[model samples]
Target chain A: MLAGSQNRVQCTEIVLFGVNVAMSWAAVQGWFHKLASPPHFYVTAGRWVPWLGASTVVLLAVGLGWSLFIAPLDQYQGASTRIMYLHVPAAWMSIFVYLVMAGSAAVGLVWRMRLAEVIAASSAPLGAWFTFLALATGSLWGKPMWGTWWVWDARLTSELLLLFLYLGFMALQAAIPDRRAGARASALLALVGVVNIPIIHFSVVWWNTLHQPSSILRLGKPTIHPSILWPLLVMAIAFKLYYMTVVLLRARCALLERERSSAWVQQIVTEQIALCHPLR
Target chain B: MIVDPQTSPRLGRALRTVLVRDLTLALRRRGELANPLVFFVVVVTMFPLGLGPEVDLLARIAPGILWVAALLAALLSLEAMFHPDYQDGSLEQLLLTPHPLAVLVIAKVFAHWLTTGLPLLVLAPLLGVLLQLPESATGVLVISLALGTPTLSFIGAIAVALTVGLRRGGVLLSLLTLPLYVPVLIFGAGAVDSAAGGLSVVAHLSFLATLLILAISLAPWAIAAALRISLE
Candidate 1:
């Protein structure tokens, strides 16, 4: 039961969200148990793929058009600020995906959940690409506005290092021959990297201040106008949906490849359109 | 011989045996011990040849160059840290021992550092002089490295354990360890960089200590976990 709220519609959502928070322990455990079965996860994620892809496209279209053409130009930086629509979100997602990847990897390691392992391993390349996009778009914005291609600011260096971390995770995954071992080992590495990320980021921030006594490159205004903020938020959500869609697709392919010998896989291969429904 | 780990039930005794065993074995193979030292000297020397011996330039970059060279030298030795043990089946025996693997891993990492990192610490001052590092900063270079190199070995142990089972893990080992080494590199060199400028060096050195403490407390479990993954 939830506490009192104003509107009836919001009351329902609030109650629902409250219950979600309250029972999350039992619910999450049962949810993970259900999803741990590869066949179930494959079918469920397959059902959601099309809807996720469609939402991503629609959001991207609106977010992209609005940010590029309709958002207000900054008084100081002018239109160059538009790139933040992609840069900030991609950068944010880069770290977001790392956490998700590492969290799933940790769960996978602890529980030996095959689906979680697939999700964790499949998330690496997406994280890397997002990191790359963040760097590329950041540099593009930097060249025109900041008068340099790069700044050794805290965020920039951390992003570059994050890229390397992703690459290293992928490299470790590829090096080991045994599938299960490789996944678990790289999962361990991912968890290790996650713990180090904050240390690296803040140390870079501290190091930057120590060396560059007078900081020239200032980050965006702390109180951004709503006109810019709204579009940025939209773009961020769209990028998230994009990640969800691609990760599911990748997970499914990886699932099939890894589980080719299982009866469910054989049944699916024998019968086209094998995905009859989502998780019941 | 399994030697019955239960016979040496004391944690201290087990740790000492592992430490002494690694150190004595490393001592017997004295020639292999020189490889990282030689590699360190050669890497530092190559910089002057490549950069044309500009005193101010080399002096400016000395801290970075020396710190990076030390890191690479440590990594060069890391490939062999556990591979030989794994090959000889002793790693399997080590895993099977009743003693805590994390504690034993700490012992092994410490021994590796004493053999590899300490020598580099001793050699760094010579390279500093060659690189024209300011005399006052040399001590800071040594101290920063003293704090940083063990952390590298500790961190590198995890990567080595993960990759030790592979036939071609050399490239993968470096890839996996190098990014994680960046924070230590920044602070280790930053400490020297500050010292050369006659600035207060406490912050950087303190950061190095922080990193060392962090690695010591956390890395053993990771190395132990990776070892289990590789062996299984």
Candidate 2:
């Protein structure tokens, strides 16, 4: 009788554990749907904006301060080498944000998720800006280091091509009048870009690239001094935070645009007007 | 879909029907057929004039010039690949059909290559002589172009499909496609450049063939998706 009761207890425990697993799985799915929905995501993202913005600003200030004032000068390249802080981080963000944009694009395409579409669309201009920043800053540094302005190096060419890809995406989106169709169409292009980007990166290696090899992303220990590497890494983090803050803000704007006729947007607009004009 | 596109007899019949229909349509407008080929010739000629009739310089640059002109010619014809079908309501009919849209897209792209890319391939040797391209290198140039232009047609069709719904998609189509064309240009011209310089052309040709196979296998689905989006 005691043994029977113990078996019963064990079976009850097993059933309860299975029940708990099922419930949590359902809850996670529910949370995902809630987050993916536009109005829900809008409210949630708006709440995140100030925090993201504050963190970004704080980190950026510190990163810049450390990068310019605190970091020691390289004995060989001297002051021009300091451009590494801006150039490397921007370059990293250019590729990092492209992956984000393309990944969101794929999600938006496959699931037809509205917030994913907004995130994908919002990320394009930021990626382009960082790419152009990287290119421009790298060129400025190159003129002094390499004795010329451009060499059509592998990374340089691929990055320039990446900028053009971003432009093409934006242009395609602008040309399409139907919002959903436009988003999905550009999403398709981004998927294709993801496939081709690696080819672009490697194809130009056949050319005798004069650009310096990567220092941080390679295998084994990074070749740079710890002090310089830290500031650069800190700057990378700050740029990433900046991207997150702006993208969330942009996603909110895009969501508003996408859902302009919805009731929630209408209520938010009216509330904003009332807040702006208290007398009214 | 039920019978499987590969084993079923319908796939072959469908491919032939589209190919014949496109070729017949292209033949009906014989003057338009010559436009890209003639454009290819004129563009090649302009290079000699712009750079002067310097044989050595022309020979040095012929591979790049011919490859680029061929690419542009292929691009010029690409806008028509689906625009006409889309306008005539056949594109909608195509989507509604039970057959896979990818098969139809590839058929149309193949017909487009036959009309545009083949002519450029045939004319490449003549232009090679005009550019004073090395006699030995001429073989490599023709072969590489023959291998490469079909890939361009296939890839360019995706852009055309995406742009077919827009009124002014001409410039937009080029902007979308030119970056994608870089790999083909590199390999096609690289093959000839290497051949002219007495370097082995094996690597470049293999790359071109690999790209062609990739385009053949993958481009149709992308074109079909783009066409669907445009229609939507």
Candidate 3:
């Protein structure tokens, strides 16, 4: 009886793991499609903006406070190591959002889903911004540690290419006259280029290189002390919230533009104006 | 739209009709083809000027420089493939032909390869000599171009089809196709450089040939699909 119960618990755990992974990736599309229809999203944004804004503010305060003040200095990198609180999460988010952006694009293209395309388009600018942050912070960290502002290392070069991919996606969409066609074509390009990113990530490990291998993420236990790890964890959550706040704003804009001709859009616009001028 | 291939006479007539029509049109706008060729020569020459008076350094970088020039030259001409025809409604007329549009598109790609690719291949050896490349590398150079340039034409055709109707698509076309060209760039340059260093070049040439065959069989259909979207 105990064995069977344990087996059931194991199965449930696996199912929950799958759900979390899927939701992390698919939540943007699901939110936009199911609950965040033009009027619902608009009205909800009006109601929830305060909560989102407040939580984000609180999270940033706590996360940044914990990371910079409480985390112990690294043994190897010493003071220069503190840059991890900024660099690692930005880098992780850059790759994560790109995968989401490309996956959404593929879904949009194959299914002709306008909502998927809107989310995909909305992800591009955010992905580009994160990529810039990763590059800038990386350069800052590299200068003090590696003694140079730049190196043509594999990861660095590939990150630059990701920026180019984002720029190309934006340029193609803006340049194309037919918006739907532009979305489809750029989606195809994104799908094709997705393979390069993994190659970039593994290139250092695959070949003998000067660049250091994985530090925070690896198969074994993390090498860092707890004092360092806690702040890193806190900062990661803060960065994620920052991303959510920005995506919410962008998605709300996209929802309005995509559903402009719908009645809900008109009503939401009217309500927005009335809120802005309550005395009227 | 279906060709009864058992009727050899009709198949031959359809093929010839496409080739003749494309060639005649290309011949009239001879300047379109010349632009890419001139760009190729200019880019190749600019390298020697930029790198300065060291023969060894020029020879060392020759393979990469030549391949880069060829890649850019191919891209420069790609926009012309469907742009003028797309603009002037000739593509619509071609679409109306009883023969398959895929076959018609393939015919145009062939004409493009002949006018643009063949000239670059012929001119490559002269540029190779200017860079002080060894004679053995010259053979690898020509053969790689022979195999690699056709793949460029095939791949570029798809980008051209995708951007045929868009204004200011030339730069965007480069961005889309440049990454796809990296494997070809690596192998083509590897072949010439290996030969220049007196290493075996056969393996690289064979790989280039395999890629070209794969691209030739696949790209026409993809380009045709892209063309349909642009037109629609």
Candidate 4:
């Protein structure tokens, strides 16, 4: 009888997942449809920037206020438990953004879409920053919890590898002269690197080693108390919004840089920079 | 429309002729064959010096050390896979042919496997004896090389294609491809270690063969794609 209700809950989650997928698909489609033309993207981005900025501020404000004050502290960890609000979310976003970046890269490769390339290039630096944040915050969390600031734990090691993969992609792109070719090659590299992500995840499970065993705080099911869980959930949502705001901004810059030769770009740049006028 | 059963069609004939010509060119420079072999020997010898002179300890680590050396040597030769042809613009001539570049890449991969990979397998028994690998372990050493070396060739082909045009691309190729090589390293080293422990070699060999098949099926496509991008 309990199994029946549990199955019902799972079915509900799957339905929710489906709805989430459709919503995300529609939202992204609407976003790109407007941004498909370089001039349109530039003008549209100008108008949307304030809204993205405002949404980010509001979400982060609400999320942080609840997490820092309203959410109860963990009995075991005390105030140090607050670190999860920053650490867990940063770590999740770091990995999540790379997958999205790589997916955009794959689309760029398959369709040779200029917008996709802009998105891929834009995603890298931001993803790298988040990855660094994850590692930094993770180290901070580790010092208080695991008794050391750093360990060659499997999860930590894999996170480090992910960072290297990002660096490799960036370096490979910088080395090649032809932008289009570089984009394609880097996209292939990204695709290949993402394949290894799963292997990195399972490396701990597959091997008996010093890495900490899987925790309830990880994906799928939560093993932590409701007190600990609520703050983490809020922080995760905040991080997702933070990533979106930054990625869209960077994508606008990348589109401008790549499409600077277009007439629309010339008009947009002239209009935007006309007030200052040329130094000449 | 004439069909020949034994002899290849015109395109096939061109590919085979090119293959034979390259093989002959390689055979004429027998000293070139010794480069990887000597490099392999030197690399294997360096491990003992670096790790200190403990024979039993050396024996224990021998399989891993030996595979690493072989992997490095294979990588060293990959630079040469397209270097000479690329420099001479002979690769362009071949590309211009009616035959597919993929076939040419396959032929080159085979030639590399023959010249470098085959020699490594042949020399494994000697290395095994020197490292005190035991008679039972010889089969594991041989089989791992047999299965693992093709993977090395296929993967190396992709790296070679990627770096074929750049000057002094050897180190970059090694760094880029080495991480991709970890799975083969794990299984190859595991196979020999398992054999040394009196465990089932069959299971390890099966895994090795699976890796080899996967490499064979997919690596040519990757190599071709990389070549097109680099040469574009």
Q: Give me the candidate number with maximum lDDT.
A: 1
Can you give the TM-score per candidate against the true fold? 0.92, 0.93, 0.79, 0.81
Candidate 2 C-alpha lDDT tens digits along A1-280: 9999999999999999999999999999999999998888889998998998999899889889999999988766778878889999999999999999999999998999988989999999999999999999988888877778885767788889889999999999889988889899999888888888887677666643312454212213347788888988889999999999999999999888888999999999999999999999
**Residue B184 of candidate 1: its Cα lDDT?**
98
Instruction: List per-prediction Cα lDDT, in the order shown.
Output: 0.91, 0.88, 0.78, 0.77
Write the residue-wise lDDT of candidate 4 on A191-265 in tens digits. 867765674455433321412454323322347667667767867876787777787788888887887898887
TM-score of chain A of 1: 0.86
* Per-residue alpha-carbon lDDT of candidate 3 for residues A1-280, written as tens digits (9 for 90 to 100): 9999999999999999999988876987777576524566556666676677777788778877777777767656666776778888888888888998899888888877776677788889999998999899888888877678886565666687778778877887777877789888778667655744553344423321322343321213357677767777777777777776777677778888878889888887888799999988
B46 Cα displacement, candidate 3 (Å): 1.6
Task: Write one digit per residue (lDDT tens) for candidate 1, span A50-119.
Answer: 9999999999999999999999887778888889899999999999999999999998899888888899
lDDT of 1: 0.91
Docking class of 2: medium
Cα miss at A210, model 2 (Å)?
11
Q: How do these models rank on lDDT, best leading? A: 1, 2, 3, 4
- Interface quality of candidate 2 as DockQ: 0.70
In candidate 4, what are the lDDT values of residues B110-225, reduced to their tens digit? 87788889999999888887777767888889889999988988887876777677765776676567666766776787788878877887766876798788778777877877
How would you encode candidate 2's per-residue C-alpha lDDT over B72-108 as one tens digit per residue? 8888888878888888998898887667899888889
Report clash pairs, candidate 2. none
